[model samples]
Target: MSTLEIKDLHVSIDTEQGTKEILKGVTLTIKTGETHAIMGPNGSGKSTLASTIAGHPRYNVTSGSILLDGEDVLEMGVDERARAGLFLAMQYPVEVPGVTMTNFLRTAKTAIDGEAPSLRHWTKDVKAAMENLKIDADFANRNVNEGFSGGEKKRVEILQMELFKPKFAVLDETDSGLDVDALKVVSDGVNRAAEQNEMGTLLITHYTRILRYIKPDFVHVFVDGRIAEQGGPELADQLEDEGYDRFLVKA
Candidate 1:
């Protein structure tokens, strides 16, 4: 099975004030077919961890190693990372003004696989995925995420995840702004990918609501740029009941 390993990662970003550390000595390992949920309060560096893994240039890896199947992930560029099977569903997906959803998906698929998918098969797969996510077929003709609602953008994100079939997916606050129905729909897509592709998931969220649908094999509590605590799925229940007040008190 594939493995994504983070070893004592320290990430920082330059701000108007100065360079500020976000992830301080964070380490975690995810294997294919495993789901790892990272729960924490706001400003706890959960999103930073996700961005770092996806090779966002804004977050500098001050000192650490990110390895995917023993290859140096940090050495790869952003597109290279995607080609390496690392995927990130951003908290706020951006709009590509001129790129239609159909073209974007096909282009990305071609880039990752190094060959364009068969037009007939690709069209069928895209149609099936959009229907499963309840996305309107008209969205195929629209520009990527252009003028889409928050919920719609999120659905499109999951749609990309489903089509890409990455080995690991870092969903940064994917549950944010999603209503109950949309949450279930998105969660179902994630679960489907895991079952079908054995995709390892790094789910970052503050609420345990998503956990109810997308069960995590492991739960990590991030506070002050480090993992303050971790446990099984039971830990998420505790967080929901007790909240991060206890962890914040310590931080």
Candidate 2:
């Protein structure tokens, strides 16, 4: 079984003058087929945590270990980590002006999976995933995220996730700026991908409404760059009722 283990992880971004720390000794674990929700307010190092795990070159891991199925992911490069079955759905997907969605997805599929998809099945699969996510069929022909709505961008990420079928996925604030209907569509895409692949996920978000649909197996309260509390599905209920105020006090 695939498992992602973070042990006393620390991350910092560099500046010309000196270094600044973001993630301070954070530790967590996600086993195969488990859905773990991490809740934190802004600047709590949530995105930093996800970026660090995916081996983002800009963020440096000062001290800690990232293990995938008992292997050290820190030793691997970004592509290596991705090919090893770790996926990050970024909070902000980049806009690739000249790269069409179909081309981008196909290239990523080929590079990570080590085989280009056959034309016969590739077109069919792409269309089916778009249909599932309610993305227009023409989205495939557009530049990657160049003219997408917030919801469309999230769905594009999920589409890549679906194509990759990574063993572990970290979804960063997939619920942001989405309308009720768009929210359902995005949540459904994530659910479908997880159910189809038994993919372990770490969903980072502020609102609990998404949880109403996704139903996390575990909910963690992150504050001051570390997890202050963690529990079963009930924790999400508590957050929904009380909010993060008590968590700040506890932290």
Candidate 3:
């Protein structure tokens, strides 16, 4: 089974004031077919953990380790991590002005798989995946997220997850700007990816509303850059009702 392990991870960034630590000591494990939801308030270092795992240059790993099936993830570069089956769906997906979605998707799939997919089969797969996400056919020809709405950008991210089929995916607050319908559609796409590929998922969010549609096998409450508590789905319900006041007080 595919596994991603984070052990006492500490990350920092160079701010205007100087270097500031973000992730204090985060340790977690996600195995194939297991979904882990990370819930916390703003500035709690949830995104730091995600970005660190994805090899964002901005975040410097001050200590600890990240392993993919016992392989040292910390040694891999950003693209190398992608090839190692690590995918990050950014909260704010950037626009690629000149690149069409079709070329971008195919190129990315090729890079991850190390071989070009059959054009005929690739086209068919893309069409079906887009249909499942309610993406229009014309989007394939459009510039990637050039002028797409917030919901549309989020949908495109999910589309990438479906097509690339990463071993582990870090969805950084995917539920941020989605409406109820958009949320459900995006959630369905995520569910499909996990179920079909047995892809391990690490879902980061501030609110518990998303847990309703994308039920997590594990729930971790992040506070002050560390996991304050962890439990089953019922923990999410408790957090929904009680909020993070207790955790904040402890922090």
Candidate 4:
């Protein structure tokens, strides 16, 4: 079974000043076919947790450990972690001026799958995934997010997730900066992927709109760089109504 475990994770980031801890004693685990939602305000360390899991060089795990399928993740580099079935979709995707979506996807697929697909099969797979997401065929040739809209960037991230089919995924703010139509398309693409695979999804977002489409099994509240609360889907409702005001008082 695919499983990701985070135990007492404390991530400190170095800046102009000294190091500052972003994730404080955070512990969580997700298994195949499970979806976990992480909700927090801006600067609550949600993105830091996602970046650290993906092996961002800037974030240091000062104390604690991360494991994927019982293997130490800290021992592996970013590429190694990806090869081991960990994927992270960023809140803001970077633009690569010369990289076409097709080229990027093909290269990533070959690396993640550990084998190159036949040309015809590769085209078919790519086309099928794009078609399901209603992405224009021309998007295949467009440079990776060079001038794409905010929604388009998020959709491209979902497309990558579909093509790579990682065992565990950390999606940071996948629903942010998206309009209603774009949100539906991106959400549909994500559901299409998660529905077909026994995916372990750790969806990090501020709002509940995306959750309406993906339906998380667990909702976690991140406050003061730690998990202040956790519960089933109903917890999302509570947060929407009660807000983090109570959490600030208790946390």
Candidate 5:
């Protein structure tokens, strides 16, 4: 089984004020089919961890080791990491003005798999996935996330996740701004990906509502630049009842 390991990760980013350290000695391990939820307040370096794992240019890893299935992932570039079975669903998916969803998804799938999928099966698969996600058929013709609502853009991200079928998926605040219905749809899609594809999930969110649907195997409470606490699903319930106030104090 594929395993993604983060050991003593330290990351920083350059701001106008100067370099700011975000993640300080964070360590975690996620194996295929395991869903690990990272719960934390804002500015706690949760997204930073996701971006770092996905090889985002903004976050600089001063020291740490990110390994995927015993291979050194920190050394791989962004596209290289994706090809190595790493997927990141951003909190705010960007718009690609000229790229159609069909073209973009096919191109990305081709890149990750090292060969283009068969056109007939590919088209059928895309349609089936879109239907399962409750996305309209016309969505394939639209430019990538162009003029779409927040929920629509998020759904498209899940669409890619379903199609690409990565070994590890880092979902950054996928529950953000989604309504109950939309949230259920997206959450169901994530569950499908995890169960069917056996994708290792690092779900980063502040609220436990999403956890109610996704049901993480482990919960890690991130504070300041480190993990302040971690436990089973019950920990999420505690956070919902008690809140992050105590964790903030520790931070």
Candidate 6:
């Protein structure tokens, strides 16, 4: 089994005012086939952790290490990190105006695998995945995420994950802006990837609503850039009832 390890990670970013530390000495590990949920209040560095893992340049690693199977993740470029089997589904997916979804998917698949997929099998796979995600066939010809609703954008993100089959997926508030039906569809896609590929997940969210669909093996409460508590699925249930009020008070 592959392992993604974060050891004493401290990340910061420069804002208009000054350089602000977002993650303070945070550490965690994820193994393929495990699902870890990070629930927290706004501005608690959960997204920063996700972005850092994806190698976003905006977040600087002031200290600590991110390792995938003992290889230094922090040393890799963003595309290099993705080729290493790390994926991030952004909360607000950006629109790619000039790129068609079909071309984009195939090109990305080729880049990640270091070889182009056979035309016949690639077409079949793309069609099946889009259908399963309930995305319209015409979207294959449309520009990536352009003019799509929030739910549609999120669905496309999952489509990428399902196709890419990354070793670990960092989903940053994927359930946000999705309706109950859309939520189920997205959650099912994530579960399918985990079951089929043994993909580990680091799910970041604020509410327990998504937890009802994507069951997590571990729940971590993030407060003030640190994990305040960790527990099993029951911890999510407790958060649903008690909320992060106590954690905020302590922070």
* lDDT of candidate 4 over 1-251, digit per residue (tens): 78899999999988889888889999999998899999987788999999999999999899999999899999999889999998999999999999899899898888887888788988998999888777889999999988988888888889899888889889999999999888888888777777788878999999998888889999999998999989999999888888889888886
Model 5, 1-251: lDDT tens digits are: 89999999999999999999999999999999999999988999999999999999999999999999889998899999999999999999999999999999999999999999999999999999999889999989999999999999999999999999999999999999999999999999999999999999999999999998999999999999999999999999999999999988877
Q: What C-alpha lDDT, on a 0 to 100 scale, does residue 249 get in candidate 1?
A: 94
| Cα lDDT for residue 74, candidate 6 | 92
What TM-score would candidate 4 get against the native? 0.97
Q: After superposition, how far is residue 197 of candidate 4 from its true place, in Å?
A: 1.6
Q: Report the lDDT tens digits of candidate 2 across residue range 157-224.
A: 98899888999999999888889998898888888878889999999998899998898999988888
lDDT of 1 by residue, 10-106 (tens): 9999999999999999999999999999999999999999989998889999899999999999999999999999999999999999999999999
lDDT of 5: 0.95
Scored by Cα lDDT, where does model 4 land? 0.90
lDDT of 3 by residue, 41-150 (tens): 89999998988899888899999999999999999998899999999999999999999999999999999999999999999999999999999999999999999999
Q: State the lDDT at 182 in candidate 2.
A: 85
> Could you tell me every candidate's TM-score relative to the true structure?
0.99, 0.96, 0.99, 0.97, 0.99, 0.99
After superposition, the stretches of candidate 1 with alpha carbons farther than 4 Å from their true spots are none
Tens-place lDDT digits, model 6, residues 1-251: 99999999999999999999999989899999999999999999999999999988899999999999999999999899999999999999999999999999999999999999999999999999999999999999999999999999999999999999999999999999999999999999999999999999999999999999999999999998999999999999999999999999999
Candidate 1, residue 192: lDDT: 100
Model 2 regions lying over 4 Å from their true place: none
What does the lDDT come to for candidate 6?
0.96
Q: Report how far off residue 67 is in candidate 6 (Å).
A: 0.4
> Where does candidate 5 stray beyond 4 Å?
none
lDDT of 3: 0.95
Cα misplacement distance, residue 35 of candidate 4 (Å): 0.3
- Best candidate according to lDDT: 1
Task: Output the better candidate (2/5) by TM-score.
Answer: 5
